[model samples]
Target chain A: MMKKSDLYIFAILIIVCVLKLVQIGYSRINFSTDILLNSFKKNYGEHIALKKDIIEAKKLLIENEITNFNLSEELMSNGYFKQRIVEFSYPIRLNETSKAVISLRNKSNTCKLKSKLNDLKLYEC
Target chain B: MNVKSTHHQDSKLLIICLLISSAIFLNYFFWAINALSFLKYVNFSILIFLISYFLVSREFKKYNFIKLFFLSLLILCLGSALTDWDARSVWLFHAKRIYIDNDLYGGFDNYMPELMNAYPLIAPSLSATLAKLIGHWNEIFPKSTNILLVLPAVLIQCFFLKDSKFKLMWLMFILLFSGRILINGRTDGLVAIYFVSCCLVIFKLFIGKNLNFLSIKNKKINRSIILVLGILFGIILTLLKNEGFVIMFIIFISTIFFKLLTKRNFSFEDLFFWIFIFLPIIIWKFMATTGGVYPRIIGFGIEAVYSESLTQRIIIRLTDLDNYKLILDYLILNEKFIISLIIFGFAFLKNFKKNEMIFKFVIFNSIIYYFLLYFIYLSTPHDISWHLNSSAHRVLISIVLLLTYFSILSFQGKKN
Candidate 1:
């Protein structure tokens, strides 16, 4: 019912469509990481988490110097810290202000923790 | 043709249309996803569909499917490349600020106020809307949006031309060759679309015999609509970029010249037409001059009012010819396929004399319009490449429209 040339054109178009779809999928995956970085950069504007701050947060979680401690839900929500926490040494209660200080421990070390309890205020810490 | 054969042809036609539509949609889908601005993409898609459906339905008999398919392919490549072209850096960067800063009127701190002042508001406004809707204003969204602007221009061109062999060839040639120019998302694409729409409206009013206006035996409503559309388009052109106003003026003047050269009767309608077209310019100029939005240039033989500053020197340096040549080289090399198509367009001019007078008029006006732009750029203080890069390919939009019209006319003639 269809000419050979017409079928050939259809095949070519289908191929192009598939190729385009794959390209878009690849580009999306490739750029999503950049988008994530851009989102952070836009929100924080060059205020990267210093190595000292990360080390201090980790140290505080390990040592009991941070008693009656509170970590804001914000601290837990920050993508960087969420992925880092290994195990909680103490049961941390979320305050009315959404802040909590908990002793956290890994195989390495501990120190006093200071963080806004509210999830939204985590970026500030 | 047998009934079986007719059914088969219909199926083939359906397949072709679906493929073309899919290609367009795929490009748009990628842009929307990349920008994370699905709503804005939807708005643009609706507009594209409406315009494309109107043209395709109206002019279905005029197209040769195979030729148009190739032409569409060429255009698709150009449109997609807008997502990454370096020359579009300024616009793409500006779109980010629309969301990041949330202030549209003031110049973004990174770009010069003068440079920012020159941009038309529509594309940027649209980009900003996309940014807000998406909640992320990155470079990709704006770049993708700019690429989408090509749809209107392509749709309008398809609408005006009748179906024919020459039309197919010309359409293919123009679409494939004008790649570099169309993808940049500058004001030129909008101007070209506006110019073509104005021409189509004018043609329908003055030349189309079937449409009766006011039920008067000889009168037509087309001219009235054309006059109104021309004024609206004129205003739009002026607002889009500073040079848009100049281009509109050239087109208006060229139309008058074409009418005269062809010995077409100059009616009172023509006078009213020109006046309506100038209305937008007059209003904008009045506001600009009196609103005190810009610094007044004042000087005398003995004294100067405003201080002569080193700032002007830097502005001049940025627009120099060397910068233009670099951009030109970039576009030519990057868009080699499109550039080749444009070269082929030159050969079609030899067959021009045999075409209808309206077709010839459009071609003549388009040539003069581009030539004047080149001349003005050579003489002006601005960087030659910046001016040319900004506007040259856009000029091809008008040529493409004219060539399509001529092709249709020639094809119809051959059939007869």
Candidate 2:
């Protein structure tokens, strides 16, 4: 039912679609498998694994009835780290206005030490 | 005239999508009225009923690909961490608040002045409802609401497949186009799918009958289906994301503008679609405004009007070629954009007369959408390069998806 010229266009469409599928299809399979395999192995993504300490420390803060907190100078130096901590332990405010301070590097000042978790130390700022 | 041939399937898909979208809104409504304690049960009831209905039906066999794709995304989402920064801080964080406290305003009282809480609540509200279903939140399952919201959009695309070749191509196209977004628990994928679907619905309402591919024997029933789909697309698109809001506005304006360009007599129906589409978003914005949850940092469009230095900066950025260069590189000078443009352009050339109106609509809509992008970029309170770099790629999803879809739809490849 199709003219030869129109069939040429249809063939071209099929070719282009085939090439795209090969290009992106391979990439997707790779990416998905990596995520799936990693997820099976770790039960969570690497980012969450990296933040496991923060998660644990958040639980500690919740247990200790910490309402507000500050970050250690080393943690404060990196904006992303600061943000992660704030978001993870949100509802527990993060500012100099807080009496509680969470120190990942044990940088000491006038704040009194309250709790510790493997260099992740909490203090009364 | 085979009145009952394929139109029923199309209507079925659209109605399911409409109901699902409405259920999300209804959850918010229930919460707004302080009746959420009861509505969650009803929500669950509808969900279980739909699932049971789908499983028992013979039509389920045809949607095998959608089912498979959704299940895969579910697994990936389940094992995935809350990684994406916006997904974590803005979207899921809002869900976390709603789940834990049943209060959207709770974060504002704390140190979250940076959170854009005014962004519509469908994503967060749906996630919160999912969490309520679980009786508590896990970092794992709650974010799956992202894919739940995306499923309807993706599933509806299956209705448009002309045959097996188209279906295969459609499968590859979604994977190739959507990529990680299909699983990442963000709303960009949702926005992209819904926006394109809106375009198609508009086309079906306007110039589609003239096209052989979309001919329906029962015009009245078909019109109802397209119109309802249009209304739902408008609402869901607007509420999905801020980009969705801008694109929905462009769709409305583009419809009238296209009619004007074609010298067609515009009807009250055009205005009707626009009104029905935007009513939900207007109420949402009103709620944000009244609740004081609206983002104040980007206050009044220009952040610091009194500061001469800031005014000068805005002018400088708007005039800067480097910023435009970055935007060009991100928006159009990329692989996906160019490839999609090429295919759509080819289809438009080969079948120019048949697809003229919809092509014109896309062109007009895209120009206005990108112009708004540029204006927003030039007028941004944030740094220009950083703003474009962070979001330009993700923001490009909707338009790019629209192009690719139309290319597939219009690629008849047979001379009429």
Docking class of 1: incorrect
C-alpha RMSD over true interface residues, model 2: 5.9
In model 2, residue pairs whose N, Cα or C atoms come closer than 3 Å (at least 3 residues apart or on different chains), thus clashing, are none
- The regions of model 1 sitting more than 4 angstroms off are A1-125, B1-90, B93-104, B107-111, B164-171, B193-197, B203-235, B262-278, B289-356, B382-409, B414-416
lDDT score for candidate 2 against the true structure: 0.67
lDDT of 1: 0.44
lDDT of 2 by residue, A1-125 (tens): 55787667557655765565344334432334544445434224434423666775676688779987777777778776676667666656677777787777446667787887765778886
- Please write out the lDDT profile of model 1 over residues A3-119, one tens digit for every residue: 787667556654554454344334422223343334312222112222334445534544433323344445556544432221111122123343334323321113333432222
- How well does chain A score by TM in each candidate? 0.28, 0.57
Backbone clash numbers for all candidates listed: 19, 0
lDDT over C-alpha atoms for residue B197 of model 1: 57
By summed lDDT, which 10 consecutive residues of candidate 1 chain B come out lowest?
A: B295-304
- Which docking category, incorrect, acceptable, medium or high, applies to candidate 2? incorrect
Model 2 error, position B279 (Å): 2.0
